[model samples]
Target: MTLIVTSSGRPCAFSEVVEKLAARRGEKLCLGEVVEAFGDRAFGPVMFFFALINMMPWPPGGTTLTGAPLLLLSMELAWGRDELWVPRWTERASVRRSTFRKLIGRFQRGLKLTERLSRPRLHFLTGSFGQGLIGIACVFLSIVLVLPVWGGNLLPAVAVGFFSLGVMQRDGLAVIAGWLLTAATVAVLFLAWRIIVASVSHGFDWIGRIA
Candidate 1:
């Protein structure tokens, strides 16, 4: 559920925002401060902020930290709210400066790569109605992302990243790509569940036959 930047020359790269946050003098960077720093571009940048947090292996409990905001953002966006808001406890969430630094290198690569390629095309997809659908999709993706499921977090995370990037940049193509990925992720999870269930049923049948 993370996203975008502007032509404001403020370094629209999500990684750059992480860099600035890391460069701050404080030992810990609060989630609220990150939200405020995003200004009018709050939706995309804020989502990306939490997404990057989720993407990283560091600072531990990364899923919980990022997932909560992702959920909040999804819900708020679904409601057509312009401003981003999280509960006081969620806002108070923080990450260490050193940890953010550790995440910068690889994380920046993926975000910058997409940023360079993505432009606002397929406008119809990012319109108000489209965004409401995206919010709902993101809500599902965020829930799956936080779950300790068999398919793991990577695919769902990538899907959410695309959704965030698409909405952030008003790039409809990217948003479509996100929906494609989201579908694939859900399919994979469902297949995995089916396999697990079949395997368990087979084991139970064998046990009964042997008994």
Candidate 2:
């Protein structure tokens, strides 16, 4: 396997990143250190990590914890910033190595499948302008993720995850898939909101009738 080393001397590929984390499975990890390890190419993988965390079936409040970082990263991307600048508070965030290792392990199979299908193509769609568009979509989705909408964060998280993968791999086709997923996410959320409103209105009418 071709190993592309980052400035921090860590492997740049997603699988290699996972392997590195696994090797340190019993140690403590800070978010900042992880970001630094990715060096100049921090945005894509870091954002992908946060997005993936939100996509997992973690405990309540996990989405908000992860989504905030995704929001910040997306904002930086949209602003055309060449380097990622995470907030000090966010940088200080820490997690157990075992937890991260388990998370990676759980998703490894799917990640491998995606890697097999991904290749650098449709270069225009993965350029700066396209990244900006993706950032905007991610911003919207991250907001949804942070909200207390029950069962509503999954689709957006998935969309962001796909976008992250596309960016990291320089695969424009994957980016296109992400955009399609984003569109579907929006439609699904709108329909769900409408249904909720209708249900609430019906409940109010029934209450009025009883009164």
Candidate 3:
């Protein structure tokens, strides 16, 4: 991989790459441009991009659209692909430059603290085996993210984000955080499902009694 430095001559961080992409001149930013900008060996940033888009205040099915890419990416990572390759159709997918800027700006602000806290320290967890494990977990998380369950997407999205950032920066702590959050997300989803089921059963009982 090539070393990319910022204007201050320091190695570029994930956030820097995001900001650079956001600042580009265009009415719309195609997914191809984004892929080309990061190139290969930027698995974390590219996956993070897909995950982060789910946070946008989009309409119903928004998470499904954004989360689909994460599933494909996680599958590739799980299979231990050396390079990232998105679908050809994704290259044609474009978002309004104004919307892109807003999302990127929000992302920068939201992740400032995370960026400060992250650094390359845990090499072992970011190694091939460890990343493979993370990729597997991300596959499940991405599935949950795309589900229509209430409040399901948010936590899974966050967990996937942590996993991506951790793998990118070689921060085992972030991966651990992802694990914990993933567990919590699952538990919450299960509880929500049970509650819905119970409520439906009660409604059925009430209807039967009235009849």
Candidate 1's error at 21, in angstroms?
1.0
The C-alpha stretches of model 3 lying farther than 4 A from their native spots are 1-11, 110-113
lDDT of each: 0.75, 0.78, 0.79
16-125: candidate 1 lDDT, tens digit per residue:
66667778898888877787677654776677667666766433344755677788888888889987777777768887878877777667677677768888899999
Number of the top candidate by TM-score? 2
> What is candidate 3's lDDT per residue for 104-131, written digit by digit as tens?
8877866777787788877888899999
**Per-residue C-alpha lDDT of model 2 across residues 1-211, encoded as one tens digit per residue:** 1233464574556767766766764477777867766665567788887776777675666677668878888999888899879878888776677777888888888877776777788888779998999889989989988876667778888889888877887788778888998999889988988999999999999999999
Question: Candidate 3: which pairs clash?
Answer: none
Give the lDDT of residue 14 in candidate 3: 66
Model 1 whole-model lDDT (C-alpha atoms):
0.75
In the order shown, the candidates' Cα RMSDs to the true structure are 3.5, 2.2, 3.1
Q: What is the lDDT of residue 65 in candidate 1?
A: 50
Q: In candidate 2, what residue range of length 10 has the lowest lDDT sum? A: 1-10
> What residue pairs are clashing in model 1?
2-47, 2-48, 3-44, 4-44
